[model samples]
Target: MTDATTTTAEAETAARPWLDASLPVAERVELLLAEMTVEEKAGLLFQTMITMGEDGELAEADPVFGLPSNREFVLEKGMTHFNLLGVAPTAGAIARWHNKLQELAASTRLGIPVTISTDPRHSFTENPGAAMLAGPFSQWPDALGLAATRDAALVERFGDIARQEYTAVGIRVALHPQVDLATEPRWSRVLQTFGEDAELSGELGAAYIRGFQNGDAFGAESVSTMVKHFPGGGPQKDGEDPHFAYGREQVYPGGQFELHLKPFAAAFDAGVRQVMPYYGMPVDTEYEEVGFGFNKSVLTGLLRERFEFDGIVCTDWGLVNDAAIFGQPFPARAWGVEHLTPLERVEKILDAGADQFGGEACPELVLELVAQGRVDEQRLDVSVRRLLREKFALGLFENPFVDAEAADAIVGSAEFRAAGDAAQRASIAVLSNRDAVLPFTPGVKLYVEGIAPEVAAAYGEVVDSPADADLAVLRLQAPFEQRATMFENFFHAGSLEFSGDVVAHVAEVAAAVPTVVDVFLDRPAILGPVVEAASAVAGNWGASAAALLDVLSGAAPAGGRLPFDIPSSMAAVEASRPDVPFDTADPLFRFGHGLTL
Candidate 1:
């Protein structure tokens, strides 16, 4: 036979023996492990987010696409796992595409199935911070809104819905339930978290995990939950995020670190199968300078040692290289011990004991490390073993295919959509309403902005703009820092400061009409202007525009209290110590402060 024919025959033979379900999970794992070489094992540990490129190749491969050329490289290097980026238009096409990829990976020795993961897809807004507008995915209300409903059953229901949607299109992992406490209002990533309270965040996060796992003790379609940013990500100094070089420290003064850990403990107790460390470092604290990805104290000492968590621990992305996205040069998360090469960073991360390198585009680097004796093959084996075991635990070997038709039915189902709407309604918190400038009686000429017309119609006549209405409703976002060209494109710096234009506009609207202003407080910003101008002002812990509207129209009561204190000004935030836990002596809105109707 020719070389091509011989290779094809070998591939076919290798796949034939594993179709039997009678084989034990351990036996299957060992068989697969034995078949994989060091190169293949290393590839399994490095997962990349896949999207289509301009040249009809994976976006991470095309030079023009600005992503690392890891797709072609993974195939060449014998990689086995990938996290599907964004959603496809049709569930059928996504399943077909995923099946084809699995076929290619199975063509090699072992026939190991490729496990695809995704961020939360069944929400109203696709988490813009994580993935860009690539294709269609089921959108749902932000987690904060979910928390507002205080319905654990609804949270579980949402999880089941997400699980069905994920399994239908071949995704087996859900990287979510970011159980981090929103203890710091200035933190930019708070919108993605459950909310500020420890007990609530933990309880809801656990319910979310149970919902996703769906009692399928071991199966492929049973979506595994990767509860993330362990030991919590909230409590950053001045509300700055750790994605950038400057804002990498995680401080704790209010003993909030322990509070943050509550949710994770709940998640672990609930049997969450996976964990992802935060990108921020515990600088000027008891822990070392590097991020949790490379912090043994946090990962090995706390999570593994104390909690006894046996789940897979994946790191946040881009920790091993200096790459630029959107015309900015961002360094790999070299937080504490500054002067290290990408290769050196990888070594430190391995030593710190992370199972996988997230957002990684290079398996070749892992191979090179193994070849140079910098990283041990046994260490690679350990992580690979855990990874493969999870695939087995997920029963991927038994059932790799999903019913695409069922997926379409599950996604955006009436039940799930209603849950989203309910969450949106529940999460809205009315912070101030001195004159009862709410529940605008019907037939009142209402001028509204920032709220959808359909949503505003429920209250009264919806106007085209703030100027035309009897009452103006303005939507606002908490201020975040702008990054320089030399920093990560999305990473924020400095304190939470609102735009002058936004403040001026709110004042303009409030002066003309009895206005109600809703601020999407992803990060807590100074609300002096908002509190002073608008007759009534509201804030949401998460992104729930619909929920804010519900509070305005008397459909839902504002029950959420501030998880973190809203700082008075950016200067006060900047002067605060990075090592201290949220001990801002004087804040605008103290923790546990909330107004009721």
Candidate 2:
């Protein structure tokens, strides 16, 4: 090494001290924080949804969510963080799009690289707000199915695999492993949770964090996890979601507030990097009645002081402002503080000690608060420090671009897909197998509903009708009453009991021939009538037709236990408290009930 080259490198390091990898993370964060202007600092406080453009180009606009162009979000808003909404047709396309975004950020004054995050993209659930279907990614079962397997090691392995896939496409953060206990069987988001048990959720949640964060440390290879809906988002009143206005109240009728905090405690133990509080306001609790995002008693007192957590706390989407989604306009989820204006809501959220606003792109509000002397610049720096430190710890400042050519080979590779397929098969819970009705003999005539003919033919002959077949196989989804709004309909929140029409149809098919029924148990369904009608009944979270057939044909073991109790009737569900687990009397299938067949 020549002295001239060494001197030039040293001078370059002095020009951008934050770029020097040898410095401590804290020192790097402070150095970057000092260099950022107020607009850039304000941008760090808002992380909203960003979409990919056509042909891996920069998106000019998004009419669906009314989001501005990527250029405006980066240049005008001075933003460097985003929650990637959708994926491209191919992994390489997504990687190219990510690189284009980084190139735009590089053109900025400070050149702070963008940090990309995403919701659970390896699942079948397509609730745009929650999870996306595994398009061009490895397909796996929902979180509830992972709980049914009761294998922390398997869960951890899934996380590690997911981390690798996410990083390949330039995603630095994972917005999931929703650890909320599914105490309320009727709740719409139950499928995303671990289960109704605190200890089990805590154990699995910690393992998930370990897998994503690369074994309890955040580094270049790690994908930072934002363990969320903190203080628990389950136990909604009447099993409705907090996403809509009618479902805003989160009741603790059983007075079990502390129990809901168990999984988050496990998350904290596993060294989670970020937290997102739910939109529901507490009812009859010691804390304020306002939403968790604006509740200082819970965010500051409980999380910060009592738990001594110093991670970045981000609010759930659309707390301070609301906009049109799916062509329908929605109001802000202010909950108990609905009377306050958007500006006032911002003030309360910042005062509550939240670091960022999820699903919001408004840094101008923070600028307004700063100019009016309502918010101290020093207060903003506290969160800016944490936010910048994460970008440094993630190694985003050094190399934000992914190798676009390598993404296609790495993501959804044959090995990774096989692991996901095995998980899908293992997660199928055989709730009932009367007289060894399963292990269906090969070449038996079979009538199928949801199973595609080509996939079913591998196990048995596929018949068009149940009457012409030797046996019948039906795939059904758990029942949920339809809501008025299009967005609300996605949330499957209503009666767990099967409707009269569905029960009669199942009985008709079973009466025609010996039947095997598989119900997609997003929520715990009342399966008593179906159990009586069918020769065999199974529960699956998310599995392909081939995976389900493999378990039924004795090729693979039915390796899942029930993640939550299935109520006997709607009356039992109505009688049980929302916050109490296993409170329903004489549940048809108790938690952990599954057959070995």
Candidate 3:
């Protein structure tokens, strides 16, 4: 007979079934779920961005979000998942901070290990509250550049490198491989996607998923990938981003809805662990006109039932909660159900079959729903079990902390950086060679734009203007219609045409000297004018100036293909329907348009 008077010390020392690695993961999940309180279960449903003090310690309060202390959020509120934002100065510093954070998690009553997640940090794109700058990580070209390369092997390699870096720093979840089709040329977020082709995007998305998750499961040394914006977020109306009120509705005039689902389907087949729906509302589709998070027809009918995807479904950031960014108030993106209270929004998300609400920290509302009998505790068990299963599958129960020194050594290693540099050079796509003007002589007089003086000096004598030079090399960005607010400017959306001044400047340079023009194609640009004006034209997806120079000088072959078609004009772009892939009529440069010198 067991004595009820046994010491609390003895009970604490006894091994739990959930802690036994020998048991099946499913059994471990059930055992843990049986022991959890409602508060702990509710905590599994919310994931919010967590802030840290500059010294790698828990901040008393976050300056931007005004969030509660890490101690209060984790121990008191029972949050075991967090999205880490901002850059840490060194890999060793971030690793040590992760160790301390894990130690805190281990000290909790149930000793549940925390699982840290991150947005894409391997690229140049920077959103203060979303992505981190590449401090100690290897910087690769943007996702679009990888698409331009058309090398699945290279994409897999990037994924593998990213996995190693993420695992070392205790970031076990990757919130990307975005997988959305870049069918809409003017969409700002296309830089993060794998260009416009369904087959290519799907192929690369699968490779990316395999690289991050490391095969079929979230084992040790793996970072689980969360494939996002399901059923395609690319077919946005008039190319405006859905972040603001004016861009909430996604209109699919082309009736090519099936094309966008291909990448997500491939992601699932590749064993992706999580999915995130976008914030846009589907207008006039078969599904209800609601945000994906609140649309049961979209989340449940399409993603869950039709696709049979059993992975965790999480909503995109801030759908239910109104947030302030840099003192500007942004309303909740609840789309169709704007009239609903925060409580109702939470309920709808759950009912729509999402397991988690992103960019939110309101588990208390979940608890209230259960207390009010609006949600079944048994129903809550489903999401909690799935969440706990992932923690187990990741082998977090066995070990969660990382070796700080190893992290420093492994991250941004010379070999990794070299591979990324090679990829950058490989992604540069030469679009035109008029009169064979490229492959410049080492001592020619050169006029350049968007290239550093020191960098341009290596190829030739860099002149101040076109008239003083024998050749002009200009690098320009794909143009976008500038939005009003500072927050909106960060996203390059709207028009695809270069303004009159930019067009005239390039033309004037070409008139004075034999010009080689290269534009960074983050999105497909209206390049008919630039192509006509320049003696030779080139395009790159996230390639550096050094890489571009290598291609132009014939030091390296331009090995990339145009991932999307270049629009002939702004009029052609507007006449095309948003939903259809490759629907633009008479494209100036067709898909797979690349020229070798």
Candidate 4:
């Protein structure tokens, strides 16, 4: 009888050495590989995204990001890996959902537990396509703000907190700690990076990797980190993001190609288990001017040979398939090889030394390619070995389930929230405290904008306008030029200057009272006009008004410095090249600029 038709008694006595955890992980992996069918081996190559319904069940709603229901993707498709999108309401809800998902995996013939990964979920960013909301997770500042504090210890501390929460909810892979340096300040995605300093980015990135991996290596307690945008993604042409066709080229006009490679080396040294290459094609480089996902020279030669990295390399999402997301059509980011067919794209990606494909659920194409005598099954095994090694390293063969009951108590505990709040306060940078107008006396009437009246009233009286208050407080987000698509708008990009109307409004507040200005510098905003208009100015990446008030009122001190230089004007930023760091002439605020009250 075939394996599928075997009885329970026959299956139990099958002599599966892979089921033995006491044996070496490599030997177990080898034994398991020998018994797998071609279809089973192909399942491990796909890592598509999955979403949950409001009731914490498998979502059967209309397609999101052009994806089908989880049942089809997980059970019928034989897929074992998923990047979790959207968050559950409670910690226990996520835990329960994860348990149910794992139950589905357990019923499969091989019983390979599904591995769930997620983008950064502990930050203030709520871009549905890019980052998940920090609901029930301790919300901290974005990566740039962490870099502003310039404390590797603090970054590690945040990572530790993130690890606790992730493990509680059964998240096993962190698809983040984006090590791409913010060399191009105008790039839309800079807000998520660690800033423009290569050395600082490298230092903090290694510390972050250590925290997720649960100290020097991957184990049952560890969450594997996928340090992303390999070879760096910060040098986009004219600061345009590579997710769109218009932003497809990554130019090196400043000729600093080696500078971008620094942080990846640091991540590799830190024993990062996975690497993700970006979508943009490198222009004027020695290698082929193809997208980094298809650049064999970059992946095989530079990463594998020169850097000596022996880890799983996955491509960024949707590089080999054309699909629609949120009703807008998106073409595959086959930048240099746009002329190739979908099958050819897959062939090229596999040949380029990548182990897995992101945002793709097609393995039949590969099965067909192998059947055609074009691609070898042994070549496919190379990636399967790396993938299986991670699963074994994570102890999925033993127990892949989490304590659904303990998830609530462990995730988003009161102590974790308090620490996250303190981090928000500490990341506030006092850029200018002219005449010590801050630290306003308690019980004074205050008029606030963009802050809750009750929150502001806790410190002082809340009034209607600047004319009726002791000091006018204003909170403003960094500015961005509008884009065509709704999804593009989520990524803040373009001009750093405030609009004429915004400048006039802040000036009116400054004229009426001693206005205290707080700018949320997701990316550095040109602050020349705002500084001249306000009596006092402070900068924060992302913080609640209470946290900012605690720092402004001297209950806590603002210790953060400029992680990156703030350009003096749009003219300066436009004049700078895309590949260079801190190249803006005469910055308004230089890197490492911060003051104390």
Identify the leading candidate in terms of TM-score. Answer: 2
**Which residue runs does candidate 2 get wrong by more than 4 Å?**
1-12
**Residue 342 lDDT, candidate 3, scale 0-100:** 96
What C-alpha lDDT do the candidate models reach, one value each?
0.72, 0.90, 0.86, 0.87
TM-scores of the models, in the order given:
0.87, 0.98, 0.96, 0.97
Give me candidate 1's TM-score against the actual structure. Answer: 0.87
Q: Predictions ranked by lDDT, top down?
A: 2, 4, 3, 1
lDDT of 2 at 452: 88
Per-candidate clashes, comma-separated: 13, 0, 0, 0
Stretch of 10 with least lDDT, candidate 4: 5-14
Tell me how candidate 3 scores on lDDT.
0.86
Model 1 poorest 10 in a row by lDDT: 52-61
lDDT tens string, model 2, 1-597?
899998997886788899899999999988888898898999989999998898788898888778899999999999988998876789998899999999999899888899999999998774666888788899898899899999999999999999999999999989887999898888999989999999999999999999999995679999999998988999899888888888888889899999999999999999999999999989998989989999999999999999999988999999988788888988899999999989889999999999999888889999999999999999999999989989999999878999999999999999999999999999998888887778888899999999889999988888888889988889999988888889888899888888899999999998999899999999999899999989999999888889888998889998899989999888999899988889998999888998887
By lDDT, the better pick of 1 and 2 is 2
Evaluation by TM-score, superior candidate among 3 and 4 = 4
Model 3 agreement with the true structure over 208-256: per-residue lDDT tens digits: 8888888765698799899989878898888877888888888888788
Q: Compose the digit string of candidate 4's lDDT tens values, residues 99-131.
A: 888888878888788898999998886455667
